[model samples]
Target: MARVTVEDCVLKVPNRFDLVLLAAQRAREISSGGALTVDRDNDKNPVVSLREIAEETVGVEILRESVVQSLQKHVEVDEPEEDDFDNLSLDVVGELSAMVVADTDEDLLTIQDEPDSGPIETEE
Candidate 1:
């Protein structure tokens, strides 16, 4: 079992900070049962990750992207998918936007006369 060090990885990843981040992220992936690019050589997860980075078996950019995705609080986009919106006709989109804009503070504050909920009151 050979030792893995930051110097070994620095050739592939120049920045010390970035190398640390990528190595740590890769270690987490390995611990989580992610596929390995190189032989483990009975090394620990962090060492195996460093070896992969040093040997260029695993791309640093991919590791960087993985780190970013793992750190994000919200993985999914809030906006609707483009394909769904594209399928709608222009007229339908216009009507939807119009409906969305039609709701005002006054409309939202007003209570409707429900059959059983309670007394309907108005601010006047």
Candidate 2:
């Protein structure tokens, strides 16, 4: 089409703000060498984008997804696998438990000491 208007594009994209955002995003994509669904007609990228929207040549859902993706700074990542403590042998578990118990016992002994007891002075 020779002329593209908001009224024409609004039929395809109901929300004016969303229409603007999607059109701008599409324009950027066009400038970045994305294939145009409609003829360029020697017009600039922004005009071509509005024309595409007006013509319904490009899917609105696809344009919406592109806009959302372009605005995203962080992408979801899969959580790391849980540690396989179940694979540990009984002997290893027993040893680790014993070490933990011993450390706890040592901590208890230290804490039981009278708080008022002054630091022991010793000659070098």
Q: Which number leads on TM-score?
A: 2
- Clashes per model (N, Cα, C within 3 A): 0, 0
Give the poorly placed runs of model 2, Cα more than 4 Å off: 83-124
lDDT of 1 by residue, 1-124 (tens): 6688788888888999999899999999999999999998788898998999998989888888888998899777687777676867776989987887777544765645325577889898
Report lDDT (CA) for all predictions: 0.85, 0.87
Q: What is the TM-score of each candidate against the true structure?
A: 0.60, 0.64
Highest lDDT against the true fold, candidate: 2
**Runs of candidate 1 exceeding 4 Å displacement:** 76-124
List the pairs of residues colliding in candidate 2: none
How accurate locally is residue 83 in candidate 2, as Cα lDDT from 0 to 100?
A: 35
